[model samples]
Target: MPELENNFYNKNLKPLARNMRNDSTKAEIRLWCEILSGKRMLGYGFRRQRPVGNYIADFLCKELMLIVEVDGYSHNFKMEEDVKRDAQLQALGFTTLRFSDREVMQDIENVWRTLEFWIFEGENSLS
Candidate 1:
């Protein structure tokens, strides 16, 4: 039996998510190839470009109820949208973590540590 269920997602969005996965950004590719793929996040499974609710998450670990988003320069102008997206995800019982593209490219170790803390230690710390 699966340990977690993805009841918050929209089935219709799967096609869009698949398309996004096919044309991933540089940051998304780097993160997936170097860290999040191959069940590498402490043996957790992560799916790239998954839709939850009305939005497509950058990356999702259903078991952890965690969404990891890699933000590029465009995100600077999309703060409002990002905030709204985060709130919607939060409403559906998921946590969203955002990291800058520079951070993922230049300081992946720190990103890994942050993810580790969130997955293993920070769940109880959420308000």
Candidate 2:
């Protein structure tokens, strides 16, 4: 595994990230436990509340440079900010996948399929 640059992992965010993990939203918990944890997503590892640049991603797959975000109710009003944040992450070579709280809560199977499709497409592009 290639070492991630120091800038991508902000030490100052460690405490905040930990707190977020401890108090995860329902959607976050479901996604992590069911799909992301223990390399369950096609054997790809994921870290929850991982700090990247100045932002904390809900779930990060370092090997794939993928960041999965579970947005809750407040996200509806922060769409612009989210877009900009995603752009910044993209500049850092991370693909951001955003899902609403309702989507993850009510239709997780679809979410899994979406993630699987993205991973397969990404792998194919690499090959």
Candidate 3:
């Protein structure tokens, strides 16, 4: 079982992180991490540079099955790709959220507030 899980991680996650290593969103990613470090909004423990099937997310909360992506202006051109990816993730029962780099970098407190609201709102709604 351990070997199987190890193989799965290598096949699915490691490659994706490799591709995102020099990604353009690093600064925004760091800012998000900083905000997440002390926040209770993650709903569970937050993992940085987490690997899921064939992908690497900027932030992941396994218990919440949540993936947060911070997009730069360039993401406007990749709506189709994002849609496709989100669909697959949703099909797997993950809730995905996206915030623009500008939002996180310029006014990060707002980002934390929004995330906190979403986390508690979702929990209350589900209950």
Candidate 4:
């Protein structure tokens, strides 16, 4: 994977990304505050609503080249679009993990465990 450069961040999307950060959904807020904020997830730093390429990722850990998305009801109608977007991100060297809003809101511990396990596996692969 190539190193992320300034060009990887779409400057045109900055305002939209900022708006998303400020107007985060309840699930997004919970995920960020409880699990991902302040390098809390195995000390991996995550940025919310970070602009990457042409899209703004919900949560991005640049070091891991990972993006986590909290999909709401609307996402059910956009599965194909989501899949394409994930593929595009993957092409850019990112691994995207997605969770439904209900999973994040009602079963937060599971979400945390899933993320922890993924990180653990990734670290082991490096070894």
Candidate 2 C-alpha error for residue 4, in Å: 1.8
Model 2 residue 78 lDDT? 97
What order do you get sorting by lDDT, best first? 2, 4, 1, 3
TM-score of each: 0.90, 0.97, 0.76, 0.96
Better of 1 and 4 by TM-score: 4
- In order, what is each prediction's RMSD in angstroms? 2.7, 1.0, 3.7, 1.6
Which model scores highest in TM-score? 2
For model 2, how does the per-residue alpha-carbon lDDT over 3-65 read when each residue is reduced to its tens digit? 675649888999999999999999999999999999999999999999899999999998999
Better of 1 and 3 by lDDT: 1
State the lDDT at 9 in candidate 1. 71
Question: Model 3, 26-113: lDDT tens per residue?
Answer: 5555655576544545536676666765666777676677788888888899999889888876766678888888888787888778
Worst 10 residues of 2 by lDDT: 1-10
Model 1 accuracy (lDDT, Cα): 0.90
lDDT of 1 by residue, 1-127 (tens): 1423546878899999999999998889999998899999899999999888899999998888899999999999999999999998998889999999999989999999999988778556764
